[model samples]
Target: MANKNHSDGDLKGTFYLVMALGVFIVVVWGLCFGLFLDRF
Candidate 1:
């Protein structure tokens, strides 16, 4: 039972980590795109 709980916690942490990375990538992409548009 303890091992199962640890696995679940790891999975939740991994999911949140992935989500934060995805959001960071998206925000950076949008900022770059906006900067490119400003040049036109």
Candidate 2:
């Protein structure tokens, strides 16, 4: 039971990290796209 709980915690942490990274990338990509469009 302890091992299962630990694994669950790890899974949740990884999920949150991945989600944060995805949002960061999306924001960066949007900013880059906007800058590129502005140049035109």
Candidate 3:
């Protein structure tokens, strides 16, 4: 039971980290694209 709890906590943490990273990537991509368009 203890092992299961630990695994669950780890899984939750990983899920959140992945989600945050994905958002960060998306925001950076948008900013880059905007700058590229401005250069034109």
The lDDT for every candidate, in the order shown, is 0.96, 0.96, 0.96
**TM-score, candidate number 1:** 0.73
User: In model 3, where is the ten-residue run with the lowest total lDDT?
Assistant: 5-14
Cα lDDT tens digits, model 3, 1-40, are: 9999999998998999999999999999999999999996
Residue 23 alpha-carbon offset, candidate 2, angstroms:
0.6
Against the hidden true structure, what lDDT does model 2 obtain?
0.96
Model 2, 1-40: lDDT tens digits are 9999999988998899999999999999999999999996
Writing each residue's lDDT as its tens digit, candidate 1 over 1-40 gives 9999999988998899999999999999999999999996
C-alpha lDDT (0 to 100) for residue 10 of candidate 2: 84
The alpha-carbon lDDT assigned to residue 12 of candidate 3 equals 100
1 or 2: which has the higher TM-score? 1
Worst 10 residues of 2 by lDDT: 5-14
Candidate 3 has an lDDT of: 0.96
Could you give the candidate ranking by TM-score, starting with the highest?
A: 1, 2, 3
- Between 2 and 3, whose TM-score is larger? 2
Q: What's the alpha carbon RMSD for model 2?
A: 2.1
Residue 2 displacement (Å), model 2: 9.1
